[model samples]
Every structure is written in structure tokens, then in C-alpha cells.
Target: MFFWKIKKNPFDYLQKSFFFSCKPDVPSVNPFKTSKLISSYFKLGKIREAQKLFDEMTDKNVVSWSVVIHGYAINGFHSKSVELFSQMRILGFAPNSYTVVGVLVCARGLPDLVLGKSVHGVTVKSGFESNSVVGTALLGMYAECGNIFDSCKLFEGMKNPSIVSCNAMLAGYIDNELFEEGVLLFNRLRMSGFIPGESTMLTVVQGSVALESRIVAQSIHGLVVKLGLDSDMSVNNSILDLYSCCKDLDAAKKVFDMMECKDVISWTTMMGLLVNLEYAVDALNLFLKMKASKVNHDAVVIMNLVLACTVLGDLRRGRQVHSQAVICGIEYDLPLANSLITMYAKRGELQSSKTIFNQMTQKSLVSWTAIISGCLQNGHPREAMKLFMEVWVSENYSLDSALIVSALTASGVVAAFELCQQLHCYSLKAGFSHYRSVQNSVISAYANSGCMDFAQSVFEEMGCLQDLVSWNAIINGYGMNSQGEAALALYHKMRKSRGDIDRFTYSCILGACSHSGLITDGLMIFNEMVEENEVMPCQEHYGCIVDLLARAGCLSEASGFVDDCFEVMGPNALRALLSGCVLHGNVELAEVVAKKLFEQDPEESGHVVLLSNVYASVGRFQNAETLRTRMDKQRLMKNPGISSLGESSYDFG
Candidate 1:
């Protein structure tokens, strides 16, 4: 009757009236219910759909804003979450505890310490500083930004800190590598009736893993089961990882078996443990077991399997895993790809590595580093330099210290002075000069390039900051250039400042003495090495001394030294003596040294070449030719075995 009283359009009018009359101000779709829909959308990974629905909501409150912001945060749209957070504040909407947590997650994604501090100010202004949830979020944000000092100060200022805040602080400590302090805090908290949650257990497990403290790991493991937190998947996985990292495979296996539901991480951790113990074959077997259980293969699991094969020197198995990864359609995974590159490089399959690298559509910084290092490791220094320069040309990567160090090594080996200068300038520009490793590599590269002047400059720039490696590199550089006096002087300077010189330091100094014919200095240093006993004289140290004496025409003294430490010197000192014999025309001494080398190892080609030269040097063409023929038929020759020092470093060879 009401519809007929109006008109043809009256029915539509009546429908609207009836619809609005019942609910009046209440929306047909409840804002809270709409918020839930957005959350559901986010859960389904429909970020755009959720955000659109949130934008269209006209009846949104603080809770409504929180839902979408939190959705963005959880979905890794950190910048968008921050943008929404800023918009909400500008629009005069006050954020609640939930909003603070969501925005703080975004803050943690941002590396700028200042942004985190600004967020902290907002929390303080909002009077959420003492609120446990907000305090935890704030603490985590600072810690993630590497501002541990402020995180500590904020935590210490909190009164009646909740278990969540305590867990955050503990995790922060572990994340920043303050492992010992984290463990100590856990001990103190345990005495104060602080019951740990699953997150807390995970953090504690991390601390124990970092310290590799077997006792602490076992204790925590017992606690995890007793407290029933082992039911948490993350907790279970972390517990397994802890036992594995501590090298307690039996305990790790026990935890693995006890896990009611194991994920890919659990399998990876267990396999990693086996690999660490050099039981890589067992690790492969475990992988087969994992497959039979139908967990499905992931990129990480396959990558770890490849590493296991690489470690076992099972190149055949490695190839099988690589094929499987390709068949599984995860061959392009960055980590898996990087592992394969290293595996192939170590196995002398550099071409295969280069192929894989060329096929990658998008390369990560790690990808670039892996290929460059692989090239260098495979003894292709110029190739390494080529790839490194490609990284610069690509400009997609921000250089890390390790990658820079590798490039520097390649540049030095190729002895490209222009490239060296460029790398030094680039390092200074890129702020990598602050890294001691980079500085040391630069010095070594400069020295290797025969640029003692630039090497000296970098060494002097290091000043008091020069580490043991820096000292070694500089001293070796001086020796390489035949500036024996300079090398000896630098070694003395290093001795005054760094008294705890290791075997390498002594080796470098002795090498300098040997190069400069400072026989007395070499003997004094050798005696000092013996006297210190801190760093026992190794084979290289003894070889340097033998070379020092032999080069000074003291074959009798060098021969006596070799006899005195025959057990310790191995075959290297004999190789040096042979070279010295060639240098000083002592054929009889050279033949005796060659016989000693053959006795040590019958397969090394180094001393064979040296002795052949010695025979030819004394106008014995027939003797040299016989030795050369035996060298050509390496395996067939019974008496003449190759020595370890192939293509000897001494110029007399």
C-alpha cells in the first residue's frame, strides 16, 4: 500500500526508507566487521584488495585504521604502513596500542636510527612509554636499527617491565651479539620468577647457540620441554638449531625426533649440524628421509643439500642436487644459486658456475660476490677482476667489505696499478676504508702490484689501527720489493707495538732477512721464535731460515739446521736447500736434498724440476735429460716422486 501511494519509482524509495528506518545511523556493514574483512584479505595475501576496502570505509575509527596498518606491516609493506601511519596522524586520528605496534614494525624495517627515535617520541607523547606492548615494540625498533644503547636505556627506565618487554630486550641483546649479557640476564630473570614464553625460549636458544655453550643449551632444552613451550613450532625449530650448532648431534637428533611436526627449518638445521661435523654423507641420507616424508622441497633445503655435497667432495652428488633443484623450479633461488657457484668453483667447475650466473635474471649483491670470489678462487684473477668491474658497471649493488676485499686481491694478482688506484679511491668513497679487512687487503694488493710507495702510504695511514695482518702484509710487501732493510725495520717497529706476533709475522720477517742476506738477523729471529714458544716454529719458519743460510753460501749450516729439525721441517726446507744449491753451484748437496724430498713424497713435481736444473747446471746434459723424462712420466717413475713445492718461488729455479 505504501509503495503504490508513491509512483513507479516509489517502490525504490520505499525500499530505501525501510532499509534506513530500521538501522538509522547504524551502517549496513559494521566497521568492526569490515575491519575483520580487511584482516581476512591480508591473511589471503590480497594486499591491494584489503587496502582498497580500508580506503572506501567511511565509518572508520582508530580500530579501523589499526587493522589495515597492521595488515600492511605483517605483509612486509613497511613503507606503505608508515605512510598510512603518517596520514592518520596528519588527519587528526589518535593511534592506540594496536596502531603503535603496527607502526613500530614498520619502524624496525627502516634502518635510520633517527626515525626510530622520532617514533619513540610519539610513544612518549601518547603516554604509551610504560605500556608493556608499546614499550616492547619501541625497544625492538631501536634494536633492529642497531641503536642498542638507547634500547638499553629505555628498557632500564621501564618500571614493572612485563615478560614481553623482557623478551624484547633479551632478543635485542642477542641480535646485537651481546650474547653473554643476554645469558646473564636470563639467569638473573630466572631467579626473579620470570616465566619465559615461547619467544623468550627462542631468544635464549639463540644466545646459547651463539656462545656454543653446551651446558647452557642442554639446560635450556630441558626447560623448553618442562615448560611445554616445545609445542611451539618456532621454539622446537630453534631448540633443534641450538643443539646442532653446539655440535651435539645426539641431542639434536633427540630433539628432532621429539618434534611432533617438523618444518623445512628443522631439517635444514639437522643437516647443517651433520655437515659441520664433516658427516656430509649422513646429511644426504637425511635429505632422502626428508623427501620420503613428503615435506616437499624448498629453496633453502636444496641449497643446504648442495653445501653438504660440496663439503663431502661428492661433485657427482652435487650435480644430482643441482638437477633436482632445476626440476623443482627453484634453481634460480639466490641462496641456492650462490651455494652452487661456490660448490662448482671449489670443484674446479668454474665454467658451470659462470653459466649459472649468466642465466640469473636478477642478481643480488651476494650473487655478484659469489661469482667474483669463485673466479678468483679458481685461479682466474683477471677473470675475477672482469666480474668485479661488471659489478661496478651494473651499479645495482652496494659493495660490502668482503666483496671489495676479493676485488682488491684480484687487482693485486693481476698487478693492474690503475685498477688498484681506482679500487682504493672507490673504497674511500664507499666508506669501506673503515673496515680493517679492506685496509689490509689494500696494503697487500699494493705490495703485490710492486707499488711499495702506495703500500707504505696505506700502512702509514693505518698508524696504530694496523692489526697483525696489516703488519704481515706491509713487511711482506717490503720483502717482495727486495727492500730488506725496510722490511726488517718495519718488523722491529711492529715488534715494539705488537709484541704478540704470530708465526706469520715471524715468517714474514725471516723472509725479509733471507731476501736481504741478513744471515745474523735471520738466525737471531729464528732463535727468538724458538725462545718465545708462544708460536711454535712451523714448517714455513724453518724453511725461511734454511733459505736464509743457504742463500748466504752457508750450505753447511743450512744442511745442519735441516738435520736438526728434520721431523718438524717436513720437505719444504729441503726444497729451499735444493734451490740454494742451484744458486751456489753445490750439486752434491742438491742431490742429497732431492733424495730427501723423494723420501718425503714420491708424487710432488717441485723438487724434481729443481734437481733437473741442478744436473743441467753442472754440464751434465745426459743426467738432466733422464730426470726430465722421468718427470714427464710422473706416475710410472718409482724412485723420483714429485715434491710439494711445484714451480718453486726462488728465482734460481
Candidate 2:
């Protein structure tokens, strides 16, 4: 056991080390070893090492050159690959199909159509154009280069196009947003007796999703199941996306449950779909399940979760998600930050919203719009206007339709006619005046700012391009301006021209009838809305009708209507009828309606104030004083009326 080992010869060890070290310089005539070494270097991703070995080779064959070229192309050295190909040709080495493909791959990576076209000339001169492999490579190169026209032409010229070639062309159409064309091409491919592969079906599914055609998407889904591609995770995810985007949540859920393995995208897609459909509880539950399953989430998932939490007013959950986003290092993600801002703002937490907005390093149009809209909604019109001014002066932000509409709304709220006109001029200069929402907002702003002529002019200019909103805006403008006859005339014109009348249109016309004291016309239109149009009357509609009858001195008819529709007639209708009672000195009716309103909502100071005013008007001083005492005991104060003097406004506080 204690035997000593014998040492090897020093020369033998040195010779073996030398032979292994100089192996890359193997005999030039024996090109196989050099090629193998180059290939091994490439396999290890040592592309430069592979190139150095090839450069040391005294006798380089096409195989040696191809290995280096392919290494360069696959390693993202696209230009170097092309340069090597040129050098190979200059050295009088003929490029085979593999070499041509390597060069074409370089072209595809470069996305250089000019170089790809020149390669096409080389393939033609070399008589490799007819080669199936070369032809497929050329097709993919051209397609990926965004030259679909040439790709299609090359595809047609192929003697027998393979499934790979067809899939390449389909991918090109889909990637270029030519979804309809992609779908049509898939159909044509089927007609040509080519079996569609997973890639082919995936492209078709994408096209259907883009077209938003549920029918077509279902058909493709059926085909996928028939072809047994339902097991493919990518295809399954695509189907999920298709169904989610089409708003077919039931079907999307079915697909998700059937999947044996669910990825993050699957869970995210489901969560996002539920959020969009207003199923906030279900979205949160699904998100919890995803977390339980240990699925990683990206910024998009966090953004959608914030929105869901906002919808549910779950501020605690929102803050938790905010913390998670911060830990994940995506709190600064622009879209997620924007969603956080919107969530906080919607929940009346403007301080938190502004804090998040201030921390954003980069803000998109949607970001600016969200904060500006939040300010406007939170009763901070001045802040909203200030933000708009910042957006206007920033070279980084461009004025969009939403920004313009929000600014116009702020202007209208403050009744700043000069600012509104300036915004209108800017819109015209910025070429956003023709946008439908912007146009609608401009009309409303002009009307609200006491410029009826401008409102009318904007409405007229819209002409046939006017939608239902446009019609509603102009008609409401006329009604609010007390030009009720003009509003009625426009309603008649809208009825004659537009067939798809909405509830807003009817509401506007009914308001005009109430303002103008057109009782008969109002009754006729109300009947048409309920009976002919089949638009169920809401509380606003009922209030308008009651106001119309009451304002016309038809107290009995108004009372009868209120009694007939008492269950559906909300407090607004009761208040309208009560005002009519007060105006016409109908004390019995006033007492009945006031009691009903008090029983409905005792906290509404308007109701108490109206009843007190009625008692005061009739010299019932004791009753009025008693009501005032009750209001003081309840600590309820009525908002004062605002009046306008020449160039100034005052509130009777």
C-alpha cells in the first residue's frame, strides 16, 4: 500500500502541452480541424475568438468562412457579417445556400432593404434564387425589412413554397398591421392545400384580435383545437388575449381554466379583462390567486390593479400595491405612476396624487391629461388650468384632444371667454379643431362664455360630420341661453336627419320645451321617447315633464303626474312641482310636497329653504321663524345665490 509512484518524462509532458496549445494552427491542408475549432468557438459564443481562429487559418474553405459569418450574424454583428461575405466573394469563394442564408440573416438583422436587395441580385447571379432554402431566407429577409411587397412577389415566384416560408409572410403582414390582409392570406394558404402550422394560426388569431371580430376569432380557436394546438402555451395565451379584448370574459375564463400551465401573461390578461369589465372584486381575487401561485408581475399588471382598486375605492389595497410596485422597482414606471395618480385623485386624495405626479421622471400625454382631469374633477379648475399652461409651454408635451377638451371645460367653468377664445385659436392653429370631442367642447365653451353666435357657427361648420354629441351640445347650448325656440327648431332638424337619437337628445329637447312653455310639444316628445323610441324615462326626464307642466300653470296636471309616477319621480321632480306650488300660491300642494321631500331627504337644506321661502312669501312669519330655528338647530346652511354685475361677480353669502 505504501508503494511510490513513478514520474513521467518532462519532454513528453512539454510536447503534449505544446501540441494542445497549437491545435488551432493545425495543418492548412487539413481544413477540417480548423473549421471544427471555429465552430466550437462559435458554440461557446466566443465569436471574436472564432474570428481570430479563422484569420489564423492559412487555407480557408467555404465552410470556415460560413462558420465565422454565421457567428457574426447570430451574435448581432450584422454589418461585420456582410463585410465578411463581401470579402469571401472577393477572395473567389463561391457562396452556397448556407452562405447565402447567413448573409440574408445579416440583412434581416440589419433590416437593410438596400443591402437585402443587393443580396437578391447576388442570389440571382449565382442561380441560388430557385433554391428552396435560399428563397425562404430571402422571403423572411424582405418581410422583416418591412418590404412586404417584395416578399409577396418572391413568395409567388417560389416553385413550391414551404410552410416556413408561408408563415414568414403571414408574420410580416401581421407585424405590419395588415391584419385583414393576413387573414385573407391565411385563407388563400388553406385553399392552396398547405397545412397551417402553429405560427400560421397564431398570426391569424392576432389578425382577428386586431379586427375585433369575435366570430372570426372563434372560428380560429376552433381550428386550433382541431389541430391540437390548444396545448401550445403561446397559442393559449393568444386565445386568452383575443377573448379578453373582444369582451368575451366567459370564454376567456374557460380557456384559462382549461390550461394546465398558466403563465404570468395568462393571469394578467384575465385580471385586466375583469378590471375593464368593472368586476373589481373578481380582479382582486384573481390577483391574489396569482400572487399565491407566485407569478411575477410587470408594470402593466400593477397599473391595472391600481385601476381596479380605484374602482372599488379600496385605498388600503391601493397603498399595498403601491408598496409592492416600489419594492419591484417599477414605481417610477410612467403608466403605472399615471394610474396611481388617477386612483388617488378619483378617491379625493389629491395630495397623494400630486406627490406621485411630482416624482415621475417622464410624463406622457396621458399622464398630463390624468392629473389635469383630476384637478378639474376635484374642484381645482385653477390648478387644472395652470397644469394646462405648463403642458402648453413644454416642448416635451404636445397638445392632444383630451387636454384641449379638459382646458375648454375649465375655461367654461370659470366663464373665461377670452381664455376660451384663445384656446379655440390655438386649437385651430394646432389642427385639432376638427376632432369631434374638441369641437363639441368648443361649442359648449363658447355657449357657456356668452358667445351664442360662435357656438352656432362652430355647430354649423361641423355640418354632416356632427355626431349625436354635437347635436346634443348645440341644442343644450340653445336651451341654456334661453333661446328655446331655436333649440326646438334644431331638435326638429336633428329628428329629420339623424335616426339614432339618444337619451341626451331627448333630454335636451324636453328641457327646451320646459323652458319655452311648450306643454303640448313636450307631452308629444315624451310619449315618443317612451312609446316609439322605447327609451325608458329616467328621473331627469320625469323632472323635465313636471317642470314643463308646472311652469305652464297646469298645477292640477303636474300634481296628477307626480301622483301617477310617485314611485319613479325622485326628489328632483318633487322639488320642481313644489316650486310650482310656491309660485302659484298653492299652500295645500306645497305642504304635501314639502313633507314628502323632508321625509325623502331631511339633510337637503334646499328643501327647507324652499319651504321657508314659501311660508315667508305668504306672510306666515311664525312658521318661517320656526323653520329657521329648526335649520339653525340642525346646523344646515343654504348655499348663497350668485349674481353678476357689469364686469364682476358676487355671491350673496
Report the error of model 2 at residue 342, Å: 2.2
Candidate 1's TM-score reads 0.70
Give one digit per residue, the lDDT tens place, for model 1 in 1-653.
Answer: 75566766776687777765677575486899999999999999999899899888988888889988888998989898889888888989998888988888888976657767887788889888888888888889999988898888988888888888899999999999999999998999899898998878888888888898889888998898889888898998998888888889899989899888987888888888888898988988998999888887689888888989889888998999999999989999888999998899889999999999999987888888888989888777767877887788875778888898999998887677777889899899999877899999999999987899999999889876789999899999998778899999988887887767888888888998999899898899889778878888889999999999999999999999999989888687899899999988898989999998998888887788788888888898898889889888774443322122222212122
Task: Give the residue spans of candidate 1 off by over 4 A.
Answer: 1-32, 48-73, 76-162, 169-191, 207-233, 243-263, 277-297, 312-314, 417-436, 451-475, 483-514, 518-653
Give a tens-digit lDDT track for model 2, residues 1-653.
21221144556665676766677753335788888888888778897788788888888899888888887888888999999999999999998877888999999998899988988998999999999889989988988888889989998887788888888888878888898999989989888887887778777788789888889878889989998999999999999999988999889999999999999889989999999999999998998899899988899889889989998999999999999999999998998999999999998999899998998888899998999989987877767888998989889877888899999998876677888899999889999867999999999999887788999999999877699999999998888777888998999998898788878888898988898888888899999888885588989999999999988889899999999999998999999998887787777788899999999999888878778778888989799899989999999988765444543545675
lDDT of the structure predicted as candidate 1: 0.86
Q: Candidate 2, 651: how far from true, in Å?
A: 11
Report the poorest 10 consecutive residues by lDDT, candidate 2. Answer: 1-10
Error of 2 at 344 (Å): 2.4
| Clashes per candidate, residues 3 or more apart or on different chains | 5, 0
